[model samples]
Target: MNPIVLWFHKLGSPPYFDRFAARWAPWGHGLGLLLIAIGLYGALFRVPADYLQGDSFRILYIHVPSAWMSMAVFAAMAFYAAIALVWRIKLCEILAMACAPIGAAFTLITLATGSIWGKPTWGTWWDWDPRLTTELVLLFMYLGVMGLYHAIDDRRAAARAAGLLAIVGVVLLPVIRYSVVWWNSLHQGQTIRLFGESSMDASMMWPLAWTVLGTKFWFLGSLLVRARADNLRREAGKAWVAQAALPAVAADPRTEARP
Candidate 1:
């Protein structure tokens, strides 16, 4: 077999994947922290305030990235769901399940920070604006996925059901992003263009970029950590799990290393 193919084949094993995840966690944390520190410094001190919004615009540093992650993680979840459904990959199912809460957390942050930003900008905390309302709906979608996953008893059944929900909910992702374009709304349009000149100053743009990158790495670290724990629980009775648990079991001689 090709070396790359062999490596991927081996990674499909839960124990192997768990070990990889553990090894990557520290590196993820280190890089994530470094990028976030730099991003925060630039966002807070180096960048000049907006002429109109002034310092209140600084909140965009957090709100923008969180909103991006909320959508990005959902898209990833839908991809994982497709893999689980098409190939019946257990790891993919676990990954899809693990992504739900993290996505939801980011969604909550987006909403909270947006509302806070709104108070100073829009003269109120809430509104029926198209983007905000759609974003609010996106939060409920994340919750629905989580709720459906937990409501089912069998792991396979739960994953399939929740995965389908996530795949279907993929439509909402674009809606949340383009709501401002599709309807007249109070929320501002996209300022940072990946391929073109951004509306933001270079100093502000760089920090937002760094913050977005930091959040991406953080999300991966969090997902792997959660998946590792889930893998352990689901595969507790396997030989690898027993061997992995042996140290703790030996330390406590009274306890069985049983699943």
Candidate 2:
């Protein structure tokens, strides 16, 4: 318990977090690029085409992973928000805010790719099915949190409000998770599960797994980058921000003055 508390304590410090984020950013970005390259290779060429869906099902390589990230990131953001609310931790709130835009991007990719996949498979670009509908709501919730954060002038107050909204809106996660079971839909059942036998072939499963891993790392990289930027924005008047920015500002002006 003491270790856990100390861990959170360290992460909650702005200077500590800024340094930690910078240290990990290079590794995160490098690994994300490597994983995406590997995943794409497996997804595009190594894996065989689906017998039923053919080339169109290949879209799942991107769509399914992006859809998974959308939900996974929100649930993660909500957990961070809960921590902030319970512990009154500013770092948690900043982390949650950082996650919102990336999660929204994944949600958008999910919708766009799903639409592309649907056109050839379902004969339409969009549907009001439960999965699709819930996904739309999920995107709105992300936007709402981000918008609310900026709406208030006071940063602390904005964080608290956004945290509250995130915690409450997490109720939608389970609904989105079980939507297929709760309602009739064109979308299929879950393919990946802990207890259930795998629904997909090994060839397909391997690529899909790689895709999921790539997407996860991509989010991690984006989260760190955005968190650093958010911290810089919030701490613009602080000594560290001034020190960090001044060097770059001076270097740029010198370069411009030279030319």
Top model by TM-score, which number? 1
Q: Which stretches of candidate 1 lie over 4 Å from their true place?
A: 248-259
Q: What is every candidate's alpha-carbon RMSD to the true fold?
A: 2.9, 2.5
lDDT of predicted model 2: 0.86
Residue 205 lDDT (model 2): 78
Worst 10 residues of 2 by lDDT: 250-259
Model 1, 152-203: lDDT tens digits are 8998899999999999999998788889899999999988899998887776
lDDT per residue for candidate 2 within 1-259, as digits (tens), equals 6998898688777877888888887777778778777878888888888899997788888888898899999988989888888888778888888899999999999999988988988899999989999999999999999999999998878988987898899899899889999999998889876577878887687777777887887788889888888887878788887776666788784556543
Clashing pairs counted in every model:
0, 0
In the predicted model 2, the residue pairs found to clash are none
lDDT of each: 0.91, 0.86
What lDDT does candidate 1 reach at residue 108? 97
